[model samples]
Target: MFFNRKNLEDHDLRHFYKKLLFPRLVEERMLTLLRQGKIGKWFSGIGQEAIAVGSTLALEDDEYILPMHRNLGVFTTRGIPLSRLAGQWVGKDSGFTKGRDRSFHFGSQEHKIIGMISHLGPQLAVADGIALAHKLKKENKVTLVYTGEGATSEGDFHEALNLASVWELPVIFLVENNGYGLSTPVSEQYRCANLVDRAVGYGMEGILIDGNNILEVYNAIDTIAQSIRQKPRPVLVECKTFRMRGHEEASGVKYVPPHLFDQWSALDPLLNFEKFLLKAQIFSDIEIQQIKTEQKAIVEQEISSAFIETEIQADIQRELNDVYASSVYTSKNNGPSKENSKRYIDTISDALNLAMERNDNLILMGQDIAEYGGAFKITDGFVAKFGKERIRNTPICESAIVGAALGLSINGYKSVVEMQFADFVSCGFNQIINNLAKTHYRWGEKADTVIRMPTGAGTGAGPFHSQSNEAWFTKTPGLKVVYPAFPDDAKGLLLAAIDDPNPVLYFEHKYLYRSLTGNCPEDYFHTEIGKARLVHEGDQCSIITYGLGVHWAIEFQEQHPEYSIDILDLRSLQPWDKQAVETTVEKTGRIVILHEDTLTCGFGAELSAYIAEHCFEYLDAPVMRCASLDTPIPMNKLLEDQFLAKARLGSTITKLLAY
Candidate 1:
């Protein structure tokens, strides 16, 4: 009586009891699969079944549930078969992902699971996106994102919450507070007294529940989820629970303090719910044992069946699935087509403006890129031409900025999002890397999004504004990364990327805005999407470069006419032109890769590796690389110049001559 526990009937208790044991079996079966080397790997959902079941049950079947790796219980409760899930784990034909997804990572559009992003905080933003889609469709469904207490520390989480609250969208941000974010305890991870307090920070309702009590979890969520359906406002419910097992199969428990482990284990949600069921006389010990045995048997049978199943295998050709759903027609711009030689600056602006004109579905968003025309005025007068709907001004919330763009992309709009400064891209790293870069790989959905960021160091904008982080996205798959030094290439490449079906990260060099200008045609001529441009051809040695460094290499070749050097501008970094690179290296017998980013793990290093392995026979010299000093771009002019690869010719020529 003092605890105020609801007097639930045997039927209700049975409902809760059955739901609670589901994830336990899922966990135990997966753990067994891990031991047997059948499942790929995962973070166990052992003691958190009650939280998953209670929260998801409160919503309708059509409502979206964006879960993490640990929410297998949530997905299963929503009616996805253990066999189909097992197929996903074994990467078999019968798996949900057609064997593309690893264990604990499954998505079912029919069940409204929509997506399962393994990375932490990005899902929060994506969940908001699901709600946005529902709102646009005028559907009465809400989106619930299951994240951890630790993910609250991520910027995408804050970005998504703020936007949801601002727009009053139908979204439930549920934080599964299992005491620890992997090895880091919650106490060490967050500064707030409780994660629910974060809800108020974003102007939303904050609900806390006794996560161990399945009934309480259900009751708390049901009330809020009902309110959301009526008015469509967001709510943040923090479920105070614990993970009884280690973080994952690979994680060791030696690091967790002994006392913390003992305390959390005692409150294990699954066992507590089972005990509650037994005490209420809803089910006898025999029935409970029978249920457990049945669940285990079912899990085992599903695992065995997955080994023999075939329909679930993901189409490997699925990789070629979502490139340009609608036929996008390209037209040569009379304003800047190749026939008429116009000023380079005018051509660059014409290229972007024309691409947006050709496709009404294209939307441009960024800071100050609207009215002020951008810092370099690349987007000057775009707002006036396109109006706010097509060319919108976004809040300086970089994470939300990109997250919103991704949402728009997923919803059938081709978005051209700009970053005022590329250095600040780190603020939205979670969205770019975890969400944008892995959308196609992790989920079957394609992200036809484009991001344009100003890069390079010569402007003296200081440490915060001037930096090159292209190598960051270069390491990630499912992203088309490009760096253009010339205006013609920039215009053509930007058009091609906007037309491509995947996410593209276009890096614009700040120094190249007006440094070097070339006449560009008025007609719409696309430099092939993954094609590189040979700026200048020679025979003495080959200089491979991109971004602002390409111009520098061209100027260097002109000054030294005696040395016949070939300059290959790698416009597209992801699917770089290997044939062009090999031919140049073979003809010259010497190669030097150059870029504006730091020397350590730069794109230049990646090119050097390619040459070392593939073009070893054609090379008469060891591949050399000229890049920025391995340090942060300093503010001072001398330091910036020294760090900007300004002496590309002196360094690369010397190395080539020596070779």
Candidate 2:
């Protein structure tokens, strides 16, 4: 209640009141919109408005801030028009996402406010990237991230903090402790009673503040931002607040205990602060009511204007607009561009060596990828070719490794993240799916990064090390998925992915690492992404595949020349060449989707559906699919072969031919 702690004056308190009023008005109006069925599903930042307003007020307009879903208050305080916010909520044209992204998913580049994923943890990494970029560009700005206490448990939380501290980045992690994450309570989630203490493990300082006190939140943010500007280190601030409403509009109070809600409801930041202001004689009840009414009127006017002016047209087309930046991928040739008899490993090894040799911004990072030359020896001689700075080894923190790579990627560096085994990618799925996949889209294609993962099931590697889950990202928008089948294709695509402006998940077939050799060009070359290569020409059927399946289809074509089989390998999945696919399907009349992943919801299934929708008229038969049986890859060599598409390929060909 007293300003002695933060040494604030009555005038400062009045400014705080004004700042808090706008955000609260925005939240209340949005809630009204949600209840009135004007806005779709929504989340409220009602009680926690003080923290958002106070923290945002402490920074300059050019400084960066990444707000989570519940930070509508932060958006308002950062100067997002209430009308625009309402438009976004009601799926109107004036929405930040052009009504594409859900309500509360507002982002503004002009305000220096970055967007984040719906899931937890991504904001922390993106904040780190923003800080790192600022550091690299020699810009005197700090990035502040707002997230719920529940997000702290995610691997990206630790990974981002550790990397930020290690690099001495200028970032502040703000945790809004609202007592609940959806239905789960924070007490049951982690052992640490205080979220701020978790920052200690990362060699950073943190504090727990009374979130109800606007002065406290503002002072804490100002102090941390000043320290970062002067010394450039990361810190965490845990604002102990309460969630007055359900997590979202759809959430009922069924999971919320009556007594628990009652207790937290009593200490609601918004109500307590208003009471404090009244008791301190800083403002009268009538004056407070007047301010509230004025704020509400402003929100109503904005919402009305938004409804009248906003046009909600289909902007989902931009969803694929900046998937990969042009300048980064379009470049001059560095290495020889001729076919030489080389293996897959040879092409990849040379590409890594040459890339590092050419660009100082390019870095190779992974477990044992340095001296050990990676698990499959794809990076042999990398450590010797490039020093420790460029070719580095990492701890067994899979999430941390890739998470740090995400930070480094936007730091003006081209980072090649290698996962030792493709199946182990599960450990880094949060970083990949939650962070890398959405960062570019959220930031309007601000992230420049690439990930190299070795995937495929064969050679008795067992379930953990032998699973193809490319579909995980196929369903996720805004990420480039590349699966190369030959040594030549590998070299070309690797260069292309490395040069790509956005993040890419480059999956290399483990079985094709060395087993399938091709005449790889001796020099580096650029390959057109999103274009499928026509390996063989035929009219009977088109065997659609990527990665190693192209070679398999090539072999199948050699043996089945009488059937006139055609082979098409999709190099990039996200911006897949629908034109090439349609053209091929039209020419062949029959199509068979092939991949090493399990048949259930695999890439083949998606391809079948896509072709069926686009090329149904040209199809002579139902779209056929060939893939591994719905079973985990086994450790036994013979069993593994049987579990994969290898044993079923011949039968699948016969079935398609019969159709």
Candidate 3:
């Protein structure tokens, strides 16, 4: 080894050598298989196995480790059966994701290993969330997360580090600087002298080590892990290594300079460690040969067993059923209670308070949500009531906060994430759509979290602040969407969303926070999601709407009593009440779907198409849709009013009635 030896025992050294050799041999076998067309592809961790093996071996068995695609040694060091891992690579049903995903793109709760998503940096924030849970539970567990040098440029990297530092969470951010991110050198990735230097900016301890020296890596990580367990805080470690192979088997290493490869080849981790073992008299030549033979046989036997395993059967129905957890729809009431009139905002706050009291595992996170309440003061006094641990005020990092919420859910904690504004969700859209939305579908992990979205356009906060963005998430699978128009519905729906096993987007209209009032129960209650409420019953024309559109329809009907209108409020959008909608379509052959979103491809489009295709025979006219004009909501009051759908409701209804 190029560095001075630490005080590792002989037995520990032997164990490290065995752990390190397994992945290098496995990568060698896999690359041969790829060339012979026996397997699909390979991301060879030929030279950087030491970082994965050493870091993973240093952590406790219960501590979680998040590894990327190239970190095969992490899975091996964690003692996951080689047969099952091989089965994963070959797309067998015995794999972690049951052939749903390939390679290291799956996590195992049983093994405490969270696999990385294709979008790399989000897992860093997820690690923060997991570390946060360990801190909250007073557990001595630490989370170790890995990323390549190129991924450091992602915003999630900065966000996760910043959040972990501010919260003083127990996380080890390991960057395996393997020289290139898909042929882009570190020179082009970042201008910093070392990746660890960026840790100083986040106010965390930083260290650098020679990744080729497994002894040094193990010792440094062990020391840091011990320190973090005692006093929980994040630490950044940069492992300077080189990627010996291309980014993948298919991509050749043509971009690498021959001289650089020759230099790194001389410092190969496996060769250097083997030389160190012989020089230190830890193992003789014959003993080392025998150990290599034994490991090679173990890898070959696992590969052979994997090859004989049953292939994935073509089961379309089973694949479809796995998209979401089975949810029960029920309208629950504790008991008869005195009715109290409350504003929409108060009902939401009351429901959250009651849920937090019932479920001790519930955590609420957002910007200024603790003492300042939220942007609308919904959680104003929650910090004092629930304590700062449960009621957290996060930094302005939506991506990290959302990802951390996911990580918290993985650790059996229910989280409530409040987006300060609905439009700001774009910052964290990847996490919501890719990570949170697909977690359950990919690995059978329920993302038991609720994201509170303060949505709609009546606030006159201009284009950025004002948007009815429920349509964005409604299209995403493995997610539930709830948009309540009234106070009681908001309260009941918020409660139901909290208790839900799937990720839910609860949209609270900003304008309706203090405007609408209704009778709410004093005790806990849950309104059934996927069910529509008949706000007003009629027969001549049917108005199907949600959120602020429901109020607009009600207002139009109150102003024009001459026209008979059936007002239907769809509380939930994803599993919306198709039965109620069909009933109304048949009763009133004329239909007008209303929404506050833009006209093109709005939720109304889905409703109109459903009515046109399924209830075509019952239609008395071409199904009309009333929605806002295709333009941004202006800051001026008059222009904002013009941009909304309220002004056009009368004409759309009159046209439908005339048809």
Q: Per-residue lDDT for 113-213 in model 1, tens only?
A: 75556667776776765676566557777788888998888777887888788767799888999888888988799888899987878889898887766
Whole-model lDDT per candidate: 0.77, 0.78, 0.92
State how far residue 121 of model 1 sits from its true place (Å).
Answer: 2.3
For model 3 the local lDDT of residue 578 reads 99
Lowest-sum lDDT 10-residue window in model 3: 329-338
Candidate 2 per-residue C-alpha lDDT over 286-351 given as tens digits, one digit per residue, 9 for 90 to 100: 999998888878888988887787365555556566444554445346554566888887788777
Best by lDDT: 3
Indicate the TM-score of model 1.
0.81
Against the true structure, whose TM-score is highest?
3
Looking at candidate 2, the ten consecutive residues that score lowest on lDDT are 322-331
lDDT of 1 at 453: 79
Ranking by TM-score: 3, 2, 1
Better of 1 and 2 by TM-score: 2
